[model samples]
Target: MENQVAAASGKLGVLVPGMGAVATTFIAGVEATKKGLAKPIGALTQMSNIRLGKRTENRYPKIKDFVPLASLEQIVFGGWDVYNENVYQAATNAKVLQQTQLDAIKAELEAITPMPAVFDREYVKNLDGQHIKAKDTKWNWALALMEDIKNFKEKNNCERLVMVWCASTEKYIETTDIHETIEAFEAAMQADDDRIAPSMIYAYAAIKMGVPFANGAPNLSCDIPALVDLAKELGVAIAGKDFKTGQTLMKTIVAPGLAARALGVNGWFSSNILGNRDGLVLDDPDNFKTKEVSKLSVLEEIFQPEDNPDLYGELYHKVRINYYPPHGDNKESWDNIDIFGWMGYPMQIKINFLCRDSILAAPIVLDLALFMDLAQRANMSGIQEWLSFYFKSPQTAEGLKPEHDIFKQLIKLQNTLRHMMGEDLITHLGLDYYQDLVESL
Candidate 1:
């Protein structure tokens, strides 16, 4: 069934929470793409292709062409940051992109500056920035953020806006009674209960303002019951928990292959070292626990030890992160996998990956913004499990399992797009064509 989707018109305001390495890199990359200085390499909205109809039809189209997504030229960038630097300055400090490329779009980046951010050091102990909103009750903080969103939309002449959390990871916190319902959550916010987090305030502000919210960190932003109910009630689309990049990205890609081959994984040890702000925040044990949980859960879901006990029942998983200032935004990871094959034959796979953190994450931020915007325009509300392809720990409905296999996630995403556009969903049943040919005889 084809659903009517609004045409992509006017400027889409892409508002990010933290204008740090990932956010700045994304903004700069978009500016560079507009100027023909660089390409949007990893963003599926810009670069990936979708297949429609039968294989014999040979119909393939770029995702941007198939779906009604905001064009790169039609996007406006603005966000909040604890640091008062403009996008250009923030990009330079990040060192993710070279100086020469930044020079080309320096003026455009400089034109965009971060507004005061709603920050609290208690949540992210490692970061304390001077450019923060006035210390106030949580309700007031949400209101202030909503005001910022309004002013930004009017000032920039944006037709629509979406918020993506590109900030540091907050310390781990479980859902409590305050997160059970909207009334309780708002009451806690008004009471300034410590249970509410700054990210939740941002989420509440965006959803209340009718702007779609996507979380790029492993924090409990819009994943709780209160916000899920709020999004559905307000008819806003929301997705995420963390952007899948670097080590976790590799894990999702590789683990599925092992499972498909029926390889028994006995143990998997994953370690990463990066000097970026993310690494620093994760250096704190509480914050690292949040990230650890996100990274570790990928395997269990993909392997399904409960279903395949002989193959994965004894699986042991360990994840570690180290903060090494010398590496800056360059993140290096090592994975040691212990697997057994037929007759319990033991084997091992070792992989050492040296990757740029923001470089890998920049496109994810861009894609989530555009896709989330499309979801909103299409009237798809609540948890967007179809956009799970870009997240590490995708937020799902209550008691639903998240699809961790990257290939499966991609199929779900593509099928959703097909379903949205009134096209036949491909099920890879090519034998049907042969059966028809034989029946004609």
Candidate 2:
């Protein structure tokens, strides 16, 4: 028997919590892709293919053709942002896309002005904006957001809605008693508890409305127990923690290979220079701590220090984000690795990756929104870990360590799609090949 999954029909509304550099880029890119003015260079939903059946089946198909995903042309974009500017204005300010590109879709981008956002100066200390909901209570603010969601869906004529948190990295906060239960969390919101964050408010509002939510930042947006339990209760699909772009994206890809080969590492130092809104938010020590934790967890999990203490237990991993205005969204990262091979001979690897931050991240936003919405349609709910391939610190069920190895995450993602489509899950066991060969002969 198969799970009762819904088909992807009708328009999908993609709501973003923070309509800044990354959100604007993604919005414009989607619009451009729809207009046939540009190709979706990095989006997997538009560009990736999936393997099915067996290695010999020759059954690979583009993921979009394999699954029932909403067409890009049918996607309508709306979002909330602290800045009152429309997406066009924000995109122009971002300077990521050129004027010629923005000019092609000017009207559409301008029409999608940002709704006033739920903002708190305390959670994001580095930046402040005038366009914000000033409700005294978090509960009231959440109520207001819920109203916004309802209006957006109706106005957009959307058959479904999904929210992606494209906001700044919130100041680090541990999960406390208030986050243990939805009841407690609602009480904390009603009480205006300082521990509750704006992202959490957005999450509460989205999941409560039965909308699928994907977190694109490193804050504990939907990762808290309150939201997770509520998602399960509400039967909504959710994924989160951070969009794995730039350096961490590279780390997840390369670190797993080293561990696979049983390589020894003494130290791995990573640092980045970026000037996007995200970089500025992360420049704050408190905000950076949250990003630091997310970026630092990958190697430890990939290397499994508990399993190979000698190789990684003393692994001195340090990550830094420097705010440099000149770089803008063009983030340049540097990594220095100290490794030992065969009888403890020391070798060093230095990598300097000059990457466009939002360029890489915008596609991640698209893939997550599409896949999370697909999960909801597939009757999947709560902590979609198979979607972990797109995140830096993936949210897992309680007592579960997130998989950070990029290749493994891809296999899980592909297998989930296969399972959803009633195809056999690939296990890479090929004893059947011999039997099939004899039969064919």
User: lDDT of all the models against the reference?
Assistant: 0.94, 0.92
lDDT of 2 by residue, 1-441 (tens): 145667888999999999999999999999998889989888878999988887877988999999888889889999999999999999999999999999999999999998999999999999989999885899999999999999999988999999999989999999999999999999999999999999999999999999999998889988898999999999999998799988998898888878877889989999999998988898889999999999999988998888998788888999988999899999999999998878878889899999998899999999988998899988899999999999999999999999998898989998988898899998887889898889999
lDDT string for model 1 (170-246, tens) is: 98999999999999999999999998989999999999999999999989999999999999999999999899999
Residue 131's C-alpha lDDT in candidate 2? 96
TM-score of each: 0.99, 0.98
- Model 2 scores worst on lDDT over the 10 consecutive residues at 1-10
Model 1 misplaced regions, further than 4 Å: 1-3
The C-alpha local distance difference test score for the whole of candidate 2 amounts to 0.92
- CA shift of 216, model 2, Å: 0.8
**Residue range with the least summed lDDT across 10 consecutive positions in model 1:** 1-10
